[model samples]
Target: MKQVDLGGSGLNASAVALGVMRINGLDSDAAAQQVLETAAGNGINFFDNADVYGDGECEKRFGHALKQSNLQRDHIFVQTKVGIRDHAYDFSKQYLLDAVDHSLQRLGLDYVDSLLLHRPDALIEPEQVADAFNTLQNAGKVRQFGVSNMNPNQVELLQHSVQQKLIVNQLQFGIKHTGPIDAGIHVNMSDPRSVDHDGGIIEYSRLHNMTIQAWSPFQYGFFEGVFIDNPKFKQLNDELQKLADKYHVTKNGIAVAWILRHPANMQVILGSMNQGRIAQMAAGANVQLTHQEWYDVYLAAGNNLP
Candidate 1:
């Protein structure tokens, strides 16, 4: 897979990241190691997980699997999101600190390559979050900081207190659910349909040099079935199939290629447990979609090209 700079942080990670959300259901050490080893074999250096994923079970399984595989810690970039617990959002200094400790203990690691605030907490106190993040950074517990599903203003609010650069902003993105990119393409037109809901989050990331990690790169909607073979997504799938044939790749691979083709330095977080699916998506990183082909897929997503 191709390597991309994780923002301007001087850290390079794979453009395709293997997300461990489904690892919780795997049997034991060997089962989990199969999933992880498949990722490593594909040259995917980035592995993303969340403390809330399987209520911490995912991290535990991943930790055990890594140890069993005997993979070197320095050879991979592992990230996990915090701030969601007990069905509530918590970014308070105490929760952040406690959560990091628990996460480290669970993952059996001394540090995480990056830590992200999973979701925006309406009740967040930016200073408290900053304090906890600073403590972690100073203690060598976390190497970098980021946020997920945050708008630009929320990022600005947190930036006021955060001394470290927020290097990444992971958000949902795919050919079927293309709001982040679509909003930019159709920004500020006279028609209400052309108005955006994202408030230019994509543009802001590009301007500030933050990497945009795309989660759910194949889902038609939020956790809905993938659009790759959905009959309702016939138009989109037709174009995707053509691209797949043109490039001699799988349809799922073409779906991922659409996101990698972007100029924002994006990372596609693949949420698959099947090892073959992992390899297929990783191959998309090698595909460089042309401007015409990229735009063609965009139009197929039901976005008008004004």
Candidate 2:
């Protein structure tokens, strides 16, 4: 896997990261351990997880499986998210503190490499969040801080008061979830494409040297379904297959390659629990698409350049 500077945090992270959101879906703990080993053997050293995934079963599985694997904790990067509840969001100082402590306990770790606020809390008090971050950092519970599904302005709001530099923003982005790219390419046009749905987050992250970790790199339309191999996206799949043939990788790998081809230097998080599938998709990080090939794949996905 290709290594990129994660949020310019001075940590070299694999461009292709394994997301353990569905790890609990595996039939057994041994299978989960195999998943981690396969990913590590394939050069993926970054892992993404959340408190709410599988209602914490995913983290538990990952932690248990990780202990069973041969890879050591310091050899990989682990990032987890918090703040989302049943019907509300919480980023209060106490909530943030307790949440991270619970996450560490579940993961069986003293500290995580990075911690992220899973979503924007409407009633967030930036100072309280800053205090939580300070406490975590002071106690050696977290090494880095970030946000998820937040617009640039929202990020700035917290950055304004938070002493620690916010270095990452996780978002839903892929060949299908192209809102960030669309808003940039459409520039002054009067189409929906021109609407900045993410408050120019893509550009903002680039300008600020913040890493944008792309989650659900294969899904389309708010988890409607994956577009790869689906009859509804025959043309797109065909294009992907052609590129896959050229690169000697799977069509699924091509989808990941397309996201890696962007100049934004983003990281891709794979949600696959199957070892073979994980290796195939992580292979995409190794193939660099040409400029024309990148746009060709983009256009085939039912998009047009303004």
Candidate 3:
């Protein structure tokens, strides 16, 4: 797998990351271990997790599985998110500090390579967030920080006070869901795609050197379903299959390739817990699609250049 600088943090990370959100669904410890081993063997060194994933069950399972695997702590980068609570978002200093402690205990690690705010808290106080980050960094609990599902303004609001550089912004991006790309292409046009729903977040990340981690790269309509074989995306599936045959990989691989083909250098976080699917998707890191092929797949997904 190809490695890229994770934003401006100076940490090298794999272009593809294994998201452990679904690890809680594994039937056994050995099964989770196999999945982790497969991912590490296939060149995926970055693992994404969240405090609320499976209600923290996934992190516990991944910790146990990592203990059973041969992969060393220094060989990989582990990241998790916080700020999301049962009823509302909480970014208070006490909550942030407590969240990292619990996550470290569950992951069996001294500190996470990175910690992110899962979602924006409308009542967030940037000073409190900065204090929490300072405490975490000084106490050696979190090495870096970032956010998820946040617009550029939200990031800016937090960055104004946080001492640590916010290095990442995780967002939902895929061929079937192309809001970021849409706003860019349809710029200056009187079209629906010209609406900047994200407050120009994609451009902001690129400008500020903040890495955008693309989560749920295969799903459409906010977890409505994967579009690979879904009849609603027949054209997109057909194009993906054609590219898969050309590259001698699975359609899933082609899907991943399309995401990596972008110049943003964003990491594609795969949430699949199945070992076979993990291997198949990782193969996309090796397949470089041509510009025309990439655009073809984009148009096939019901998007217009405008």
Give the alpha-carbon lDDT of every model.
0.90, 0.93, 0.92
Model 2 Cα displacement at 83 (Å)?
Answer: 0.6
Candidate 1 on 45-103: residue-level lDDT in tens? Answer: 88998998998999999999999885789999999999998878999999999999999
TM-score ranking from best to worst? 2, 3, 1
lDDT top scorer: 2
Regions of model 2 farther than 4 Å from truth: none
Inter-residue clash pairs, candidate 2: none
lDDT of 3 at 293: 97
Per-residue lDDT of candidate 3, residues 4-90 (tens digit): 799867899989999999999999989999999999999999999999999999999999999999889999999999999989999
How many angstroms is residue 141 displaced in model 1 relative to the true structure, after the best TM-score fit?
0.5
For model 1, the local distance difference test gives: 0.90
Q: Choose the strongest candidate by TM-score.
A: 2
Stronger candidate by lDDT (1 vs 3): 3
Model 2 agreement with the true structure over 1-306: per-residue lDDT tens digits: 799897788989999999999999999889999999999999999999999999999999999999999989999999999999889999999999999999999999999999999999999999999999999999999999999999988999999999988988999999999999898899989998999888999889999999999999899999999998999999999999999999999998998889989999999999998888998998999899999999999999999998
Write down the worst ten-residue block by lDDT for model 3.
Answer: 1-10
